[model samples]
Target: KKVSEFIGKTTNNVAEYTALLRGLELSKEFNADEIEIKCDSKLMVNQLKKKWKVKSPNLKPLYQKVRLLLSAYRKVNLIHVPRSIIKAADKLVNKAINSSLDKDVEVHFVEEETESTLF
Candidate 1:
């Protein structure tokens, strides 16, 4: 399974958490009893596994949300892997970023043309 989204401007930590949240939502929708989440973010993996504390105030809310989502599953495990191991996910993220940038450039070009026509 693969998923990607443009979550706008956010730190790497927030983006990682957003991905986790979305995956949990999808799992619940499908009524999945067990889920193994693999990611390249070691910090997030550790935080969720309770191996490390979530010290950032900005991340506290996201950490709490993850905990809430985990309660819905009969079994869940978060594993950390090297970035090279998650090629598909990395490609998806790059595709989404490029897609959004292309749209932004198109919008800027159209706005410039519209302004020119107004003169």
Candidate 2:
């Protein structure tokens, strides 16, 4: 998040994007074989689904990455969740600078060899 500030990007929007990407990454780790993304940002939700075009250069790459990640999964969906229920993401977006959240990441896939249910 601090890096975004140094790069002259809106931390809120970047945090939102980071959260969305993290969700997609997690789905793959769970060996989900499918992915579903839920967000309160209508613009982001629609752009990833292609229901609307992304006119902002800032948002275009993120949208494209979501599409590519979706292809890696057997099935993927980008859906909207009402703001009332998306608490964690909201906090991430509205966090104060130098916040402790800098160490709290929701979706990371650095581990190797995930467990298999079939065993």
Candidate 3:
């Protein structure tokens, strides 16, 4: 699943949190019990993991929203990876930004599976 949104100008951390919020919302829609989130922002990762405090007033509400959404899941793992690993996502973000340069727009692209398979 992939989602892209143009949320206007904002801090990078806010954008990271917004992306996580969108991903969590999608997972909830699918009734997923467990999820693994990969992000390139170390600050966001650490904040979610509770290893670092959310000092910014602007992020407190977003942090609270994340916590509220996370409570619905049985298990959630947050991982921090290098930006290089997420080049495709970056491209999607760029595409969304370029497309919404003149207007406010949010785009979501979900790849659906044709069949369910048991492992």
Q: lDDT of all the models against the reference?
A: 0.69, 0.56, 0.72
The TM-score of predicted model 3 comes to 0.79
TM-score, one value per model: 0.76, 0.65, 0.79
Q: State which candidate, 2 or 3, has the greater TM-score.
A: 3
- Of the candidates shown, which would achieve the greatest lDDT relative to the real structure? 3
Measured by TM-score, the strongest candidate is 3
Which tens-of-lDDT digit does each residue in 1-119 have in candidate 3?
A: 55677887788889889878987888877887777677778888778778799999999999999988988777776666667766666776677566654333353323321221111
The pairs that clash in candidate 2 are none
Off by over 4 Å in 2: 1-11, 96-101, 105-119
| Candidate 1 C-alpha lDDT tens digits along 1-52 | 4566787877889888987887787777688777766778878877877779
> What's the lDDT for candidate 1?
0.69
The lDDT-based order of candidates, best leading, equals 3, 1, 2
Error of 3 at 96 (Å): 2.8
Per-residue lDDT for 7-91 in model 2, tens only? Answer: 2346455556666676566666576776655567766666665678988787778767867777777666555666766665454
- Model 3, position 6: C-alpha lDDT score: 80
- Worst ten in a row by lDDT for model 3: 110-119
Off by over 4 Å in 1: 101-119
Higher-lDDT candidate of 2 and 3: 3
